[model samples]
Target: MKSHRNLVVAATAAALAAGLLVGTAGTGNASSDRVDSAPSSIKTVSSGWSIPWGLSWLPDGSALITERDSFKVFKLTQSGTKTQVGTVPNVVTTSGEGGLLGIAVSPNWNTDHYVYLMHTASEGNRIARMTFDGSSLSGYTTLVSGIKKNKYHNGGRLKFGPDGYLYATAGDAQTSDLAQDKNALNGKILRMTTDGKPAPGNPFGTLVYSYGHRNPQGLTWDSAGRLWEAELGNSTYDELNLIEPGKNYGWPTCEGSCSTSGMTNPKRQWSTGEASPSGVTYADGALYMAALKGERLWRIPVDGTSAGTPKAYYVSEYGRQRTVETVPGKNTLWLSTTNADNNGGEPDGADKVFQVELK
Candidate 1:
């Protein structure tokens, strides 16, 4: 088995060196607009997490993390000690990808104490809000529901935008036709208030901010206040999209790039094998994306709305990365591994959180 693994690595390295593995290495162009180096070091912050799926930092410098299958949430201190915060109510795991997912603390957490969560319920995927008193969670309220959920493709990423509104990503749930439906919440990025109503400036006066997404798991904003997403493709090309209100992203009609009218093309794309891009966070001038099947972190330099060529780092070194978040007011990033889950198939104690120093 060791010999076979070595041979596979050697073959993959040869393919990468020969330019056969697309987007697996840095594009050799030396320019100021592109990422020229990878992260300098990766230090494990914590271990023994069971498929840590969500990470959100609190004002007190602590982080709240969620376990996908266990439906439990933990409060992790900056020094790496984890204490069980509590389990989310009514979360159910269907396939491996479902169950407790993305989490975000409210921007006014000091006053309201609200924390948002996206999870798989028995009926479908839903978003809920809870109150946290810095130790325990309570006051659960279901904000949104009826998002289609299948055994696969249940998109569950939650975030609070810079505009102080909640933003969510919903998958097509394997129903390709729903991606094109503007009225449906599936396969769309939704912008809403804390009460789950549509935001005031939402396109179409509905919660649907943008439509035609396959399974977007990442959402972040650049320093310029432009929204960006990393979406998983259907067997062809994954995308890094510049999201605009009321614009169509061309998921079912076009996988990567097309000339279709009323469709927006991705700023950058990668073959599906090289980039099942998941969580994304923007820091400095680059958008860092966490890859699952690609098993790496991609640094895509962003200038205004355009993205330069991507550079890969930690390829196959940390197993499957599920989330990447920029530490607030710091040059470090917090990353979570999903190797203990069914997809990665690594041994027990395989899941971990790492603090990476950006170069």
Candidate 2:
């Protein structure tokens, strides 16, 4: 993003300490100012870049943002300054939905000095660990691997739960029938330890936390710790599902919802044209979803487990939204547009990141 290409040089120590302090990306300074509201205004924080896919905050309030094709990560400050922290190794693009995907800073970062990344590798999609000493990245080690990969359907979003376990999304990898195979890792939500082993209390005693997914690209937890997933459908619909451990979500059996007895229906479903959704976040008692093909942002209010009607914002104003993240400690959001590659057909370096003001 052009706004991200900094003119003012930054100190290494101060720049590296930008984000992280547990419980979320925001800090205590603005903790009391926290409000849950829908985005009312938007500002361009960074401009003119490739597909900026993943975003994570550092402990000191600065954030780390990733580009899909470049396989690079930039550290962005709240005031609009950015610095290149370092590039990840062993990342390969599928020329479709692969490359550097999701990133998460350890909740125990102060003592661990660890950061995690999910990316497309030579063999398949893998989750890897690297040491980020507050400045640069080093020491790459594969924590989880052997996930089947395809040009599309490579679900790659990562987050840490309140229970201190890592959770990830794995798509069906174009093998739709395999989504029903609990013996496989593809098409499931995986819960694991930092070392890549299956977390304790997982369903089926495997990494699979929940199964029967197609191309689930988005995940977020609500106030009650309920996991919400956004999945891309085959032809008819996309889904917003409230995930439960060991529950069967009908994939090949049904696209949106069906009368299948053992299948769990979604909380909400959208037409594929309206929502090729990705990167969901909880804000203001609602879920702010980034729509890729819909080219808009969706604000769906939530009361307990009930999802209210969704209101569309900035419809067609920003083209092809990819990621929307809460700017910790505030009732605002940071959204990115991916108008550069894949179906967008725009020039390679024509993307942007925005700061959305919430009510």
Question: In candidate 2, what are the lDDT values of residues 275-339, reduced to their tens digit?
Answer: 88888999868888898876668877766766666666765666789888888888889999888
Q: Candidate 1, residues 1-359: lDDT per residue as tens digits?
A: 11233445666666656656545221132245655445788898999877898888899888999988888889998799999888999999886578999999999999999999999999999999999999999878999998988877888888999999999999999998899999899999999999999999998899999999999999999998899999999998898899999999998999988888988988888888788988999988888999988887888887776687676777676778889999888888999989877778776567999999977
TM-score of 1: 0.93
Compared with the true structure, all predictions reach lDDT values of: 0.86, 0.82
Backbone clash pairs for candidate 1 read none
lDDT of 1 at 248: 97
Worst 10 residues of 2 by lDDT: 20-29
Candidate 2 TM-score, true structure as reference:
0.89
lDDT of 2 at 20: 17
